[model samples]
Target: MSRNTESPVDVDEALTHIDSRGAKIRKEQLERTLSQLQADSELTADQRLAVERLSERLVDRLLAVPRASLQDAAQNADEETIETAMSLFE
Candidate 1:
């Protein structure tokens, strides 16, 4: 018989795993892009600080919402209301 290697995933655990994987990719990209920017002298201290702060805020916001609820709201929303709600993210 073939052995199952995977643990049964709970919804929250699954989401957490997905987020962890995405964060790894994002971290690598950020490191590479930031190194390039530093090499090119493209960013000021204030700009770097602003980017760090905004990235923190975005991670906080993402963690604040349940994925199912966000999906439901987005799917059910009418266009204008969705646009307004999306504006709040910006």
Candidate 2:
């Protein structure tokens, strides 16, 4: 039997592949992708840092949404839940 010797995938390489697709992924999808990359055992220290920074940027953008908009979207939701969501930015 022939043996396969392919190397494990790198996080940066995976990111490059995703970026090359040129399709806009939703924030939640991107967050899930990044979380998967972060969990990869082959990730180097730099790759882990990059993944963390990207996650932070995503969270920052999410938290930047106007409070009024979030409130409107979550109509019927309790005020405490809305405030808890907004507090993630702080």
Best by TM-score: 1
Question: What stretches of model 1 exceed 4 Å from their correct place?
Answer: 1-8, 53-66, 69-90
Off by more than 4 A, model 2: 1-35, 38-41, 67-90
Cα lDDT tens digits for candidate 2, 1-90: 223365432333333333333223444566676678767756787876676677667645653444444545355534444444434333
Candidates' lDDT values, in order? 0.55, 0.49
Overall local distance difference test of candidate 1: 0.55
TM-score of 1: 0.48
Clashes of each: 0, 0
| lDDT of candidate 1 over 59-83, digit per residue (tens) | 6576456445444544554333333
Worst 10 residues of 2 by lDDT: 14-23
